[model samples]
Each structure stands twice: as C-alpha cells, then as structure tokens.
Target: MPWKESTTMEQKIEFICEWRTGNHTITELCRSFEISRPTAYKIIARFEEEGYEGLRELSRKPRGTHPNATDEMVVGGILLLKEKHKLWGAKKIHKLLYNDFSEEKIPTVLTVHNILKKHGLVSPQKRLRRVKPIHPIFDPKLCNEVWSADYKGKFLMGNKIYCHPLTIADSKSRFVFTAKGHYKENLASAKAEFTKVFRKYGIPQQIHTDNGSPFGSVAAIQRFTRLSYWFIELGIMPVYSDPSHPEQNGRHERMHRDLKAACAKPSAHDLKAQQRRLNSFVKEYNHVRPHEALEMQTPASVHEFSTRPFPEKIVRFDYDSELKVLKVTRNGSVRWGSYNWVYVSASLQGKHIGALEMGNGIWRIFYRNVFLGFLATIYHLGQAKLRSNLI
Candidate 1:
C-alpha cells in the first residue's frame, strides 16, 4: 500500500515553486510554504537531484561509501583509541580518528563513546566523594537538576579592598544561579543573599556546599550551621565535603577557578567597579560561553527558574500525630514515643519536638521549630554494654 499522509510532499513542493515564481522572497516563500530556510533549501536540492520525484523524499542515509567499512572495523578502531589514550574523552577520540583516518569512515564522538562503553573500556565518572547519594545528583539527564554553590574566596580589588563572591549554579543544566559579591564571608551575609536566590529559583532538592562554616560545619559532613539550618528548615538538604577535600566539591571549585580567571584577576579600583565587570562576565558565561559538558550549548538554553514558590514560613512537621507519645523538657532532651532523644542545647526544654521519620534506621530530632539532629538505631547496644561491663 502507498504511504498515507495528510499533505503530500509533491504538493508542498509545487506550492513552494508557485510562490517563488510569483516573485516571493526566500523568507516570504518559506513563510508561505510553512517551512524553514534550511527546509526550503532542502526542497530545492531535491528538485535538482532527481527532478520532482526526488523532491518527494529520498533516503536520508549517505550513499557511495566503501562496502569494506564494516561495523566491526569501526568498533575496533574506537577500542584501540580508548586503550592507547585512556585519558582522552570522546571529542579527543573523534579528533584522533579524523586526523588518523579518512573523514568518510570516521564516526561521531558520541558513537565512539558508545562503542567504548559497550566494550567496557571506560567507567562513568565517579560522583563527588564527600556528598551523600541523596544530595540531588546532577547527571544532566535533561538539564537543570542541580546547581553548585560556593564562595570564590576573598581577593583584593585594585584599590586594595577585598571582595568575596557567592556563587550558585544548576548542576545538571550548568545554569549559573548567581555570581555576585558579598561584603564578607560570614554566615549572616551569605544567608541574606542566598535567601533571595532561594526565593527566586525556588528550593532545590539539595544544595552541594563546601565545608565552610557558613554553609556547613567541621563536626559533621551533613550538619547544618545557622545558614544551612535555614536550608533544612526550608526542605532543602545541605551537602558538605570532607575536610580539606576541595576536589570532592569539584564543580563549584572549578567554577571558582574560571570566575577568578575571567573576572577577579582583572581588578578595577573598587568593589563596585569590579562587580560591574564581573556581571558582564557572568552574562557571557550563562548566555554565550560554550560548555563542553553541555555539548557546547549555552547554559541558558537548558535552564529555567523553578515554578515552586519559596514559603515565607518554614514548613513544620508534626510528630504528635505520627508518634504515639510526645515529650519536651527544659534541658533540650526528649523522652517520648518510646525513645530517649538528646539535643545540642539545654535552652530548648519545655518546647514541642517534631520528629521527621527517615527510613533505614534513621530519624531527625527536632526541638520546637529548630532541627536538633538525626538519630540512627543502635542494634548491638545490649551486646556492647555486656562486653563493656565484663571488661
């Protein structure tokens, strides 16, 4: 049976020719034919290739390649490159193939990577070391799932005044959230500024942060300081890197390097002027700078602010209904729901405790409106106690 269609390709071609013969401009012809410039050019090419018949629809596959170029040969070449240059990425592999072999036989970089992966020649890149698995992994499956956050550290302007940049990014989309200066690197300042971002962008499921006091603490990898505590209160999990492990949070670290190279190094007389210049660079970074991870697309093309609104009041979870019992004491310790809970401060006694259930033997202990910390079941406690007493 002939292929059934709503509109015939021949008819579309005839329309294009008629419009052109009537002295319609290329743009006007394209508009009248409901086609793009490239599509119009394709139709014209078809008309020349095999006359009107060719204009109907030819096979998209390229023709006249050597029959000897088998799939196995292409796979073998890709595997050889992977073995020889274990460090080279897909683009570099493609370049090597183009430089070494004829262009007609060479495949795309994506195809090369696919072949390498199929042969188990390489492993996927490891995730950030210090981050928890739940901290919004940003594989860029489509775009804009995660955004990196950090301060660029402090540097002097031409006038010798210091400027500290607080940066945020979309991890999956590679969209730059913000790249503006803060008066200082303190928690209050960082919180005040980042609040604006949370308000504008809505809350990300998780925000990856370095082991800085403002974003995190030295005691625990996922512990929240005052600013990060605010994030937790807002339903955003705070992720932290191990101490002295800057590379664990490599994305933000890398961005800082690029930001410094692009904006901070070329210092102006004051922070205001330097910031003005930095703003321009940020605009370029988001709208023009080609990202290799994004397949050379600008970050803006793959990013948009989330529609979820940032609630002015922090969301409160009620444990009274979930737990069989509820308790509060002036000493910030709670004995309720058949469990004993200890909190950091003694001042929170007599206030209500909210318990958020985290699965797999974990529970978050909260006092009044503040989240005290998490708790995990100690299954071998009786055995350890017996051993200790025996000792």
Candidate 2:
C-alpha cells in the first residue's frame, strides 16, 4: 500500500520533529522519505534554530541588509524623479537609480510600477477621449506607391517674414520627395513645386495629406480643394488624415518635429535664408540620419523613383463602348440612363459618361476623359428621370 502524503507545512514539520527526536536516524529517514542528506539536515537545523516557527516557510532573504526596501518609499522616489525630469520610462528610471543609488540593488521597472500601484501613487495614463483608431489603409508592397505631403508649418527668418516649407516623403521607403518651399503657401505654388517633383521622380499611385485648407477642406472630405484636385485629375488618389488627430499622419508629423528641432535656431531669419538652411538639412536627413523605425537605414538608401512617367498631355478616356450621358451644367450634376444625380465637378460635364462593369452590384462613373468617382446602384437608381418631352 502507498504511504499517506504530507499536504501542509505543519504536517511536514511534525514528521521532521518525529525523526529529529530519535524516532529514526537522519540517514534512515532520508531513505524512507526519498530526500537527500542535505535536505534532511536543513529541516533538522530549521526546527532546532526557531523551534516550531522555523519549520514553517520563511523568506530566504537576509534581514536588515536592504535598509531602504520600504515599498511606499521606493515608489514615492520614482514618482518624484518622473515629475522632476521630463524622462520617466523604465529604462530611464533604471539609469537614474544606477547613478543615484550605486550601493543599492534597484528593482526592475515592473517591480517599481507594481509598488506604485499598491500605494496608489501613480495616475492612469491620459488617453484621447473621443478619437477613432486609425488603421493604415494602404501598406505599399513596393516602394513609392504612396507619398505623404505637408507643409512643416512656418518659421520666421531674421528678416521677419515666415518660410512655409512643403515636404514630401515616400510612404514605403520614407525617402523624402522634396523639402523646399518659400513663404508662398498657396495651392498654385504647391502644384508648381509638386509638378517639378513628379517630373523628376515620376507619379505615385496616391499621396496623403492633412485636411488643412491648403491641401483640403473640412466642408468636403472627398472633394479635392486645389492641390489634391489636380492630383485626382492626374489619376492619383488623394488620402487625407482624420480631423484633429495629428498622429494619424505620424510619419509627416515626426519629420516636422525633427525639422523644427534641427532648423529653428536663433540666427535663422527670412524665407530665403530659411530655405537655404532647409536644403542643407534635407540632404542630411535623406542620406545621413538613421531612422530607428527603418532599422537604422537612411531614407534615400531604400527609396526608388516610380516607373510611371509624367505625360505632357493628360490622358483622356473615351465613352465609345459604354452608356454615355452629358452633364448639362457646371454644378457637376448629371443625367444618367434614367437617373438625375450630382457628381464632383463640371470638368466631366458636356463630356460623355461611361459606365464600367465592376464587381457584384458595382459600377464606376467616368467622363469623356477622366474617371469621376463611384456610385452605388441602389442609390444611383433612386433619382427621377428627366425627359425632353416634359418641357
């Protein structure tokens, strides 16, 4: 028959007590209990040293060695350090402890935070209350499929005028498309500058920007204001960030911060001088600076220009094969097979409209030469038909 097992520490202590009081010799007890001599001796020694109390489990840590191990005090000090210095993550805190308390064994960051929680010394992290989570809609499998563009705000030069810089970066390679601009922040000026860039680097599939008035407008999320409208006319999709969330467009935002830190100095003054400074910095940023997110690779090293060439004359499609409709007014409102509907602009009016067969229940609307946009069949069929016989 199998022997009964000792479940609790007290039962084990009683068994040890029986052996130590001469019920059995140490070596014989070790054989019966299937324990080593050292284990048997440890139990015997513990019982002798503190009577029955020692037989119970006690912390193996030495007493009075760490004079400053109070949980509340340690957590308090960490909070103080975090508040005093702008730096306060685990790695930073570890470095601080190493510098300040060389003789003490600093606890891990997890341990420090646990202590803080126990004493309620730390507050919960502040999070944006009403912001929607942004997921990256397009991850370019190839370099240069998409590029992000924006003006890195403006800075005053020594001449007291502001320099508005327009920056463009490849979404995949993080290669800078361009980083030069003057005080001119208008759409026409931006278009001219981007035209030059497109000529050199070729056209990208899409370009992303914030909803700033220069790039787009809050009133119309899909309608291209001016800079974006031109791109759409040229076959490039314009992507816009969510309103009020700068980090949704993180790459451009990060670059702007770095540019401000590097270029905004005491001596810089007018727009021209600032442009010169920006040119120099762009060279360094593209070729020299290592990006942590890119595995320390310089942006230029990984970036490749797109293969699509910029055509001198914008290409126009014909409505020969499909159903055609003439938009009668400049309001972008149009008359289709049996339905009257509004569209983006008159750029497609007076031009033949073509319907391209897409997936199940989907169709693309096009003008004499350009793709206007998409419309759902259910919604497109709901409009009243206009007849010539109705006067």
Candidate 3:
C-alpha cells in the first residue's frame, strides 16, 4: 500500500486525517501508508506537537555536534606549527603533530588542511600533471637494487656563491644515500661524495641517472662518461633516463623538490653551514619523514644496506676462451696490426676488450659484456685497410 509518488504529501495528510477520525487503528494506518508502526506514531506525535507544520518533514540534522570535534587549542597549535615550519604542508604538519603529541588527540590530514584554509594559511593548489612514461616500468625489487643520482641545479647561497647539490637515493626503499651540497658539479666533486656513500652503503646492482655531466656525457656514444665507465668497472650497470624527460627519474626529482623546499629555500652562508643543513635534512628524510608511497613508513624502516661491499681495488672480468682479446692502448686505440691503430674510448684504455666474430671479417667488440662496436678489417696492398671497415 505504498503511497503514490505524485501525491505523497496529500496522501500522508489523508492518512493522518483518517487516524484522527478513529475509524482505523494505528497499525492499520501504518500498513495503508506502507510505513512502520513507529513511523506512524512519530507522525501522529509530530501532528499533536506542531499541528500541520509538524506533520511536514522536520530537519534531520542534530541540534548539537559531537564533542570530539577539533578544539580551538588544536586550531591554534596548527597555526603555530604552520608559522614555525613555513615550508611544511598539511600532511607534514599532521605528521609532526602525531610525533610531538603522541599522547594527545590528533587531527586528520584533511581536518588540518581545512583549519589551514580557514586561517587563510593554505592557498588553493593547482594540480601538477605528470607526463606518463611509455617505456617499460623498471622497478627495483629490493633495497640497493637500483640507486638514482642527480645534480639539483645550482642555486645562489646567502653569500651569493652558487652551490651545486649532488643527490642520490635508493629507488626501492626511498632511502636517501647522499645529499651532498657540492661547490661544483665536476667529476672530482661527484666522485668524492660517491666514494663516501659507497663506503657506507655498499654497492648497488644499477645506478640510474639523468644524462648530465659528471654522470654522463652528451657527446659520448651510449651517453657514457668517465664516471659511468667507473661505475661499470665496479660491476654496477649505469643507466640514463630518456632525454628531456625528468619524470623518467621522477622519484629522485621529487626528493629534490623536498630538499629544495627544506634546505635550499634559505641557502646557507657557506659550504660548512650548508652541509650542516643537509645533514639535518638527511636525518629527518631518512629517519623521521614518512613517505606516502611506502605506506607511510620512513625510509630507514625498510631500507637495508647492500650485501655487496665495495672492493678495495678495481675488479676485472675474464672473457670466455673462444672470444679473442684486444688491449686498448694508452692512445685510446687498439693495435689492429703492426701500424694500424683504431680508436675506442679513452676510458677503455689499458682495458681488454673481447671480440666476438659476427660473420665474414666483421667482429663485434665488447668491454666486459657492454657492446663497443663492430669491426671489419679489409686487406689492401698486402696490408689491412682500416678505411670504412668499421661496421
């Protein structure tokens, strides 16, 4: 006996009117209205209390809100924290609140954001669109399986001196291995900091980097540089992101953002002072700051040191017996015969390259599994003609 959708109000009025006449019991009226007995009693009670006005629907909202709502003191505390750590956003503030007031009630992230919005502290954030990578996803399964390196663009410190930051992090665990603020982005500066990190964290299976100086050379084939060669020599595969695409190295870039916000915003007066700030940031980044991607766990909680320790000296690889070996001379070339010297990379000098015969006279050369190029020796005038023999 559901009421017609077209005349619901009129039908309720007629039903109540019928009850008022005492022709039918409340239970029978409820069945006619397709409502429960409690609903019928409530309607009658409302009609008795407020006449026709009460018979109409009343507001369902509670007159009083729950007492567990955020307190004025909490609002004040959030503002105070926002003022103290001007660079921190709502999530960071919330995390700090939990850390500082573990025994007290803490507000949710959205609640904290609302409080900030009410106080005109937080501005409307524009969504940052990321360019999706079309390449196959490369995920490091364990800690130290892959490490990312980058040089955050140099910024002027308080002393008006430019400081080039060298940053490296564990890809899987989001653990920061090094965040050294170097004076320069040259090979010397990069090597020193990397050596320190290697001594501490051991070696990773692969080192991923942007195609930049010290890490790589744009002119070098395969984007290989001296530093890249050194990494390969250490048995670590050095990889690069696609050119002009920062999102390819997105994780390291995101860390750079935080680092910039936390430390570089107010650049230190000198290297020593800046290093101290970097030290503090590293401590918090690794041990205190929670990453949303890691299920809100700090990097230190999940990151384990790599088992492969850095060797005391450079390690060499022995080739198979069938593969022929060629020694790259100091001039960055191999003695193909008595007088013919063809160029390889200077970085490969004094190193043995394994030659695998492809077909005909053409042979493929490799410096420890890394492909160098193909070589074809053509004999002319009773001697091998170098010519365009390189394939």
Pick the lDDT winner.
Answer: 3
Alpha carbon lDDT of each predicted model:
0.66, 0.68, 0.82
lDDT of each residue in 305-381, candidate 1, tens digit only: 77566889877655566632245466645553344444443333344556666687566655434455555544453
Q: Which wins on lDDT, candidate 1 or candidate 3?
A: 3
lDDT score, candidate 2, position 293: 67
Quickly count the clashes in candidate 1: 8
Candidate 2: global Cα-lDDT? 0.68
Q: How many backbone clashes does candidate 3 have?
A: 0
> How well is each residue in 340-371 modelled by candidate 2, as lDDT tens digits?
56454543334445656576645666544445
**Candidate 2, position 145, lDDT:** 84
Ranking 2 against 3 by lDDT, winner: 3
Give the per-residue Cα lDDT of candidate 3 at 297.
Answer: 79
Task: Locate the minimum summed-lDDT window of 10 residues in model 1.
Answer: 382-391
lDDT of 1: 0.66
Error of 2 at 367 (Å): 5.2
TM-score of 3: 0.76
